[model samples]
Target chain A: MSIKLTYFDLRGRAEVIRYLLKYGGIEFQDVRITIVPWGNLKSTVPFGQLPIYEEHGKVSNQTIAITRYLAKKIKLAGNNNWEDLELDALVDTTSDLLEKVVNFYHERDTERREQLKRMVLAETIPFYLSRFEAIAEKNFGFLAFGRLTWADFFFTTTIDMLDAMTGMNVLKNYPHLQGVVSNVTDLAVIKEWREKDKSSVVLANDAK
Target chain B: MSIKLTYFDLRGRAEVIRYLLKYGGIEFQDVRITIVPWGNLKSTVPFGQLPIYEEHGKVSNQTIAITRYLAKKIKLAGNNNWEDLELDALVDTTSDLLEKVVNFYHERDTERREQLKRMVLAETIPFYLSRFEAIAEKNFGFLAFGRLTWADFFFTTTIDMLDAMTGMNVLKNYPHLQGVVSNVTDLAVIKEWREKDKSSVVLANDAK
Candidate 1:
């Protein structure tokens, strides 16, 4: 059976997994829910959350988990030994920041929103971006060396997610992160697959 | 070379990895930081965060990542295939909630603190703990089937952390979670480990 990814058509959480599949040249049945139809589909998800993954009759929830599972299936995790685990953990760090950003978007008011964004830009974004940049500089391209691990895609997705949501140029401050984002997006398979579906739910900030 | 774990010598983020080491019975240099001494260590960690794992001469940062790395090392992930991924994701979910609790503690002032705690008690804690209880119930003891995955330890750690920090008895409402917490703590290794280094860092509500 083909892997089935269920989420709202928007790239809210499922985008990274979708991007990972395309980047790795893995085919999945991407099931998108129309905003109009999400109400009916709401209860179908475990924990009433989207971005559920079903493969070969097994089901799992949580975006990071699903993305990692897909990365595992596509062999995009890492080479061997503890590398896969490292890649998985690195990808999770992006999810960690994304959760913070999501909260900033929804929970913070206008007065605090700018402060929150600034906090992330100053603390969160720089920390991870600089680290990823250092990793890229060390490996000369890959985040974990020699191979494109889930961490690479996750980093790019996080940058993209932030860009899409906030209308802010998160990577402009760090050209290296932009380079990594560009590399992941410009992958031949990803380019081909993404063009076929313009509805990949680019966040509002990503529009730039 | 021996494994090195770097954090603030507190159980906040590094404890899970430390627990995994003890649970798996792996010997490694704890590398406790007697003082944060951020001036010296700040530049070394990715995202300026802690619980970095150095194995095979490569270093990785992020507590969850370190935990998964150690989980893989100890073969505590699960039986085979997707079980491990699902387990890790579930653990991630519980950690996600715990992070919110931390953030809640950090963000709220004294005036709104109790209100915020009530919000968590009503929403975040119950939402995750109840689901965890359900997962454990279905699995007949563990969060994942027939094995103790990282989720089990993560949940137990959450209880321990919350109990130490809030004194709110977060687990009292959830019988199953309390039972699981009780059972995990009862393990000889964990019990012994706790006895050895029970002087952990606790963030009092007034710490800020």
Candidate 2:
């Protein structure tokens, strides 16, 4: 049975999974849900939240979990015990950083947002991106493994999100990370998907 | 070679992994970092953060990743495909809820904190914990599989954390969730661990 991907129309959290499926050449049903008329669909969601994934009719919520599930299905998880762990770590760190961008809206006019972003730019993003870069440098410039894992894709997604949110380009400071993000976006299938439905994927607020 | 668990002595984020290690009966070198000597130890932490796991000299960060690594090592990740994926989803959801708690602190004002906590208590926590309860009810009353997965432990950990923070017990409204938390804590190993470290584990500020 084809997996059912449920989320809103916008390419927010669910887009990464969609991109993963497209990039991996996997077939699945895309179920787009919007805020309107959620009354009927409310009960069906795992936690009354959208962006759920159903495989063989067993549903799962939590976007990152759905992403990991897709990655696992596509064999995009890293090889070996250590590499797989690194993949999870890298993806999670990326998730945390992206969430900070989300929180920036709620934390406006407060020093907390700037404090948080400063921490991210100063320590968090640089730390993970640099570490991934080192791994890439050691292994022919791939993020986690010698090949592209979900970690690389996740890192690319974060850079895209951050760069879009903040006018300042996040990757300019990290050259190796720039290379990694460039490589992922330059993937043939991904490039095709991005261009094919550019309007659908692009967000108005993401005015880079 | 012994695995090295790097984190501060405080059981802030690393407690779950420590609990899992003790519960699983694995011994590791707990490398407590001291900040009083910040200049010395700052360079060692991968992301200028705590709770890094080093195995065979290779290092990693991200709390969820560390927990998953340990859980996989101890065979606590569950055996079947559905169980494993479900567990991952559950853990990710729990992590999302915890992030809300962190946001509560950053919000500053009592009014903002209350608003955030109410939103969390009303929408986020119940939405997650309730569905998790249903999943647990359907699958042996744990978060996933026939056995306790990292999701179960993470759920229990978050329950303890939320309950302590709000002075409102997680079990008060959600009976099934309370049951799951109880079931996990009642496990022989978890029970013993809690009994031995009651004072330290019970934070005073938990009761809002």
Candidate 3:
């Protein structure tokens, strides 16, 4: 099957899907659109959104949806229906955190943005991360079911983007979250992919 | 298995789960908490959020997570992985519409709220509904795979809430979307449940 993943060149929503593909040793075309060309390309896609995955010419949008599909294919999904529910819940919760962080990034007012950033760094991150840490602690450094699931991958990838955007060390105090990041990146495939993909470095430079 | 669904008395997020259970012939406890008592019960839940589904003794949070779980159990999920991806994408798209409507409802400034509501009714609704209409038109009035899936159910239930919250007739121009709503509510179980559930009447009144 010819597979292609399309999104902006930035390491935004598409990063998790890319990580999943790489970690699973799945081969796919990575189509990245620059901001200048996104306008011309936006309406051509389903729902006028990016991070779309096309397999055999059939396209699907929505970040988590794509991730979930790839996760299931790569055996990153849970063992049962209930376990999948737990994974979904955790993934959505982490997405909520990312949404708040994105809002802070997009806020135009400097003072308000700073205040929002402070709140995100202080209250919001801890509120969600502490709970995630607890879950990972129980699940042996994995986010769900005591093993690798897409939730861990989702959390690790998006949290890295959050850290890049905010210039904040999010996992400094949360050992289990740090463990999740390490566990995902420690995979041989992911480690090799990171060596070749400079998207993280680009994101860090953009934040600066 | 004993099932209990807890959320606010309003049909905001929990209504989808309620509809799924009723449609699937599954029995569950409908635990509705009013705003007054919510403060006392907030921290007791898993993530301090509502629309939690509890089976036997274990509890899970996140509205879509709960809905997706029930969908799988009741055969409302897609027949295969690719079809499931389509369902997830469509469900998430409808959710994006609901989120914007929610923002309008929560906006404090009258002028700003009016502007947001206008955008929601005009650009936002059409942008999403038109695409959905096209999808439904192709799939025999169903949102995904030409049959009843949870995406159809999610769109049906949440679109009603959006209509209620915004006091707008979202599906007036989209015959296919109207067909989806009718298809879901036309189910014997849902029809019977709606007759007894005063929440719909309450929402109708609120829209007035």
Candidate 4:
């Protein structure tokens, strides 16, 4: 299969896709663009964005959509349509959290960034993490299912980025969430994937 | 059949779900909540957000997931998994556009809001709209498919929201997008749905 994934070598949005691919043992090109050529490369990509997926010569963009495609290909998606909907809803909930954390991370102004950091740490993180912890608790250490789904991969990879941004273990008090994380990262394939490449797995700040 | 959709009486995020239900010819309890009770109702809803769809007893949040669920029921989703992925990627592209516009619309500071407006108008809107126009032109008046799909419904509904927020006809120069909008709005069921309920079809600003 001529499958190729293209993005900055950052663990920001593309991390979950990478995790899913590694977990599935899918083989394809992992294209990592550095900072210098991005400007020239940006216009050439679809929708002027990173993280485009190419399969059989047809390329597509959008992180979540691409993630779903790979997840389905790897048989990590929900068993039925209704199950897929549940997983999609769960991914979006984590996306809501990721969006907030990303905004804080991307903020350039020092004063405003500090203000956002406070709101995120004080209110936003607890609000979503508490809900997520409860859901993981109910799902038996998974995010939205009894077994590992793409939602687990999504949140597990995302929490690493979130923890990196905050400079602390954000899931310190949420054992279920921490369990979810461990369940994902401790998988043999995932551990092997991480050990395989340390360069392309850099976080957002380090990617810059 | 217990189908219920609860949201503020606004076209902000829930409009596409409303459109899908109308197009599906499905009878649903359209519960329009007013602003006064939102605070109390916020914590009660999953994800603390509006536009929650309750079917039988399963209550779910996240607008896109709900849209896909209703679309599948209505036979508006893609015919296959690959087709669904195509439609999903298209929806996510529009979502990228929507996120930028919503942030611009929701900014409380007047000066920063204006700055966002300029960037949105001069750069972001064109960046997305031109690409959308080309895709529509290729698809012969549809957004992502040769025939009407949920992506069309998504973009058509979202363009209305974007146009209202920008206070201008953003698609004036893009004939294909304009045609896509007209095609969706002129649908017999959608037209009837809107005509029957004017109170709940308000846009984001007026809903406040």
Best by DockQ: 3
**Number of the predicted model whose TM-score against the real structure is largest:** 4
Checking candidate 1 for backbone clashes, the offending pairs are A163-A205, A163-A206, A164-A203, A164-A204, A164-A205, A164-A206, A167-A205
Can you list the residue pairs that collide in candidate 2? B164-B206
iRMSD computed for candidate 2: 2.2
**lDDT for each of the candidates?**
0.73, 0.73, 0.85, 0.85
lDDT (C-alpha) at residue B71 in model 4: 84
List, residue by residue over B1-208, the lDDT tens digit for candidate 4. Answer: 6989998876668889988988887888888888779888999887798889988888999999989877888898888877888899999889889899988888777899899999999999999999889989999999866788889899987887787789888999999999888889899988887677665333455334
Question: Distance (Å) between predicted and true CA of A118, model 1?
Answer: 2.9
Candidate 1 displacement at residue B3 in angstroms: 2.5
Task: Please state the CAPRI-style docking class of candidate 2.
Answer: medium
Native contacts present in each candidate (fraction): 0.60, 0.72, 0.86, 0.70
| Model 2: residue A15 alpha-carbon error in angstroms | 1.8
Candidate 2, residues A21-54, lDDT tens digits: the string is 8987888898776556667888866767777877
User: Per-residue lDDT of B33-96 in model 1, one digit per residue for the tens?
Assistant: 7554865887767666677788767787777777776777777776665877788678877877
Q: What is the TM-score of chain B alone in each candidate?
A: 0.89, 0.83, 0.94, 0.94
lDDT (10s digit) by residue, model 4, range A44-110: 8888898988888988888899888888988889898788889999998898898998888887778
- TM-score, candidate 2, is 0.87
> Model 4 clash pairs?
none
